[model samples]
Structure formats: C-alpha cells, structure tokens
Target: MIGEFAKRQGVKKVYGIVSDYQVGRDMWASLKADMESKGIAIAGIDFTPIGTKDYAILLDKAMKSGADGLALIVVGGDTVTSLKQGGDVGLASKMKVMGTMLMDETQGQSVGAGGALGVHSTLRYHFTQDTPRNKRFVAAYRAKYGELPSQYAGEAYDGMSWWLDVVESTGVWDKEKWVDAFRNSVRNDSVEGAKRMRACDNQAEQVGLFGTAVAGGAGQPPVTMKVTETFTAQDLFKPCQ
Candidate 1:
C-alpha cells in the first residue's frame, strides 16, 4: 500500500528501512521493482540486523540518502528506535515518514507525543470511525472487552464473521470455495454501520482518517491522533496485477 501511495503521489526517489526478516527483504525487492517499472528511482536502501539496539548509524545513513520519503518496516522495539532516531537526526521534519501495521496506535506512543506527530500509517479500523456497523461493533466490543478494539482484533472478528457468512451462503466448508467467496464478496456494511470493507483483500475499504499524535487527554493514554481527513482505500490500494 505504501508503495502504491508513493507511486500515486509521483514520488521519484524513495528510501526505506528494513530488518533482517525475509518478509522485509521481499517487500523491499518487490517495491524496488514496482518503482522501477513506474520509472521512479530507489535512492537508498538500508537493512539493520534484527534485534539491534542502536539505530543512530542506520538512521543517519537514511537521512543522508536524499530520499523524498521513507518507509519503516521494522516493528516492536525497532519501530520506536527508528522514530526516535529520525527525530534526533532531524529527519522526521525533512522527509515524509510512513510505516506498516507495526507502527500502530500502541507503538506510536512510545515514539513520544510530539515525536510522532504528522507521521502517517494505515490501519483497518479506528474506534472513532463514524459508521453505524462500526458503532455497534465498538459498543459490543467495549461491552465484552471493557474497551475499544484494536485493528487486529476488529479484523479477526470480521474475518471470522465473514467466513461464517460465506459458509452459510455456500453450504460448504471447502477452503478453496470459501476463499473464492470472500474474494468475490463486497462488504458495504461494517459491524459498526455502513462503512465499506473490501472483500478482495479482506481489508476495510472505507476512508482512513489521517491522525496526528497529541498529548493524552485526562483519562487517556499518551498518544492519540487528531484525525484530519478520511482517505479511501481505493485511493491507496491498486487492483492486483
């Protein structure tokens, strides 16, 4: 999705940080191809060994690479490391920084309220989404879990319910058949209300609310986004080739 977004924005030179995982390496290779096909330049590529404690050197390399944007694929401790390193080196203000699911609401806090401001990332759902099905899902989730559901939890519930719907519709539990059904289904209704969910990728296709980390409110935690605009998934994701 980040690659697609960069392509759409006509980004010419892209840089990214990845860990020593196979997925990270594969993603970088794939995006490199995609960008090349689109005539974009990959200005820099940096790989940090997994579980590395210090990122100052890697972050400095990324900053000096003259990239128009940066994508961070490292998660957990590394996500925080990348963010802090970017801020300390003044790269956060110099480049457009985006991240994967690992950089969700929880990790955003660890980067500090001010340090994480204006950083962009994607998610399947947010509690503040205004759809009706989402409202019900939120209410029921809170009723059951005593709080809001994270993106992962919401997607898990939705995936199960979606599978059930497919099973009942087809009267078969064959894995291939169910997969086909899910691929063909169009979810215009969310557990909260009428928010759109894309069946093709099993991802919510509704507009994403752009949020910025702010100081935690009186009973709230340290990191929260002040949603700026709602962007559609169609705008972010391209059809599979």
Candidate 2:
C-alpha cells in the first residue's frame, strides 16, 4: 500500500534507509519488493546501527541519490531521531518520505506534527479507525490511560482478549490445547476489526492501514494518521500453504 501511495504520488525512485538488524532488513526487503514490483526504482539503500544519532550524512546521500522519496524502515527511538533529522535537513521538500511503520501517533507526537505531516506509512492498527468497536476501545483506553493507544497496545489487548475467549471456550488451561485453538481462532470484535489466525503460519490475518500524518482535529492530540486506504486481509496476505 505504501508502494501504491508512492506510485500515486508519481514517485519513480526511492532511497532506502533502515536500521541494521534482522527486522529492519526484513522490512526493507519487503518494501523493496513492493516498490520494484510496481515499477518504481530503488536508487540506493543504507543501514545505520541502532542508537546511532546523526542522520545528516545519510539524509544528504538520499537527497543526492536523485530519488523521488526516502523509504524509511526504522522503529522506536531511531524513528524519532531520523525523522527529526530528515525534517532538519529539509528532505521532505526534496523527496517524499514513507515506508512501513514509519509514523504512528506516539512517534508523530515525538517528531511533532509539522515534522510528521504528509509522511506516508502503513500498519495493522491505528487509534483513529472509524469503527464503532475501535471508537469504543480508543475512548475507554484514553479515559484510563490519558492518551491514545499505539499499535502494540492494540495488538496486546486483542491477543489477550482472544486468548481469554479461547480459554473459556475450551474449558482448559493446557498450553498445547490453547496453542491449537489459537491456530484456528477468529476474533470478530477486535479493535482493529475482525481477523483470524492463519493455520499455516500462525499469523494474524488482518487489515493493513495506509495513511498520512495530519492534524488530529480539535480537542485531539497534536497529530494523528488520516487513513487514506484500507486493504482487506484477503488482499494483503498470501494463501495458506
């Protein structure tokens, strides 16, 4: 979906910057495949060690690469620093900024709305999903925690909710039985909407949300993602083997 967004924005080439780690490598690979498959070019790629602060050189390289966008595949604190540096260097004016999990509500808040604004990203969940169940979840969560929940928070809550349901239905506490049940379970009321566990990979098959960072509106946080596209589980995940 990020690739689709890039194509929609006429981004023909991109420079990839990712954390030097297994997860970061995986994310970069996926983005690379997606963008290339859409006929977009990967102009160049670089991996930075986790916790490395200065992104001036990297941001400069991306700008010099003649790419139309920066494919950022960093997470956590790295995301905050690199995004701030990207803004500091005025990279957004030179190239579109986007990639997987690049900007979420917390990171957007940390980077400030102006820094995160217009940056594109994709993830499994966002607090601003306009479903009744998600609306309820966000309201209750904010009422208790005094802020919006992140993707991790939503996943944890959904996992626990599904687990308790399976436990109650099976009338057993055996881990083996729970694992088996989990492989075949589905949650219709998940905060991110309905999803089912794929028996083959034991992965949750759910919606993929694509959005750009924008102001959170009146009485809201400084920033929030405005979902621009939604890919169904069937459209995203491959068939179970």
TM-score of each: 0.76, 0.90
Q: Worst 10-residue stretch by lDDT in candidate 2? A: 123-132
Predicted candidate 2, C-alpha RMSD: 1.9
Off by over 4 Å in 1: 7-12, 36-40, 170-183, 191-221, 226-241
Clashes of each: 8, 0
Q: What overall lDDT, based on C-alpha atoms, would model 1 receive against the true structure?
A: 0.68
Across 1-241, the per-residue lDDT of candidate 1 in tens digits comes to 5665566656668787888789889988887887778777888888878777888887777668888777777867877777776667666577767666644466666787555765666665567777677788879988997866776777677667766876678787688897777667656666533334456556545555444455556545566655444566565566644
lDDT of candidate 2 over 1-241, digit per residue (tens): 7777787778899999999999989878887998899999999999999998998899899999989889888877888888888877676777889878888777787898656887888866877777777898889999999988887788687788888898888888798998898899998888888889999999999888888888888766677888888888886788987
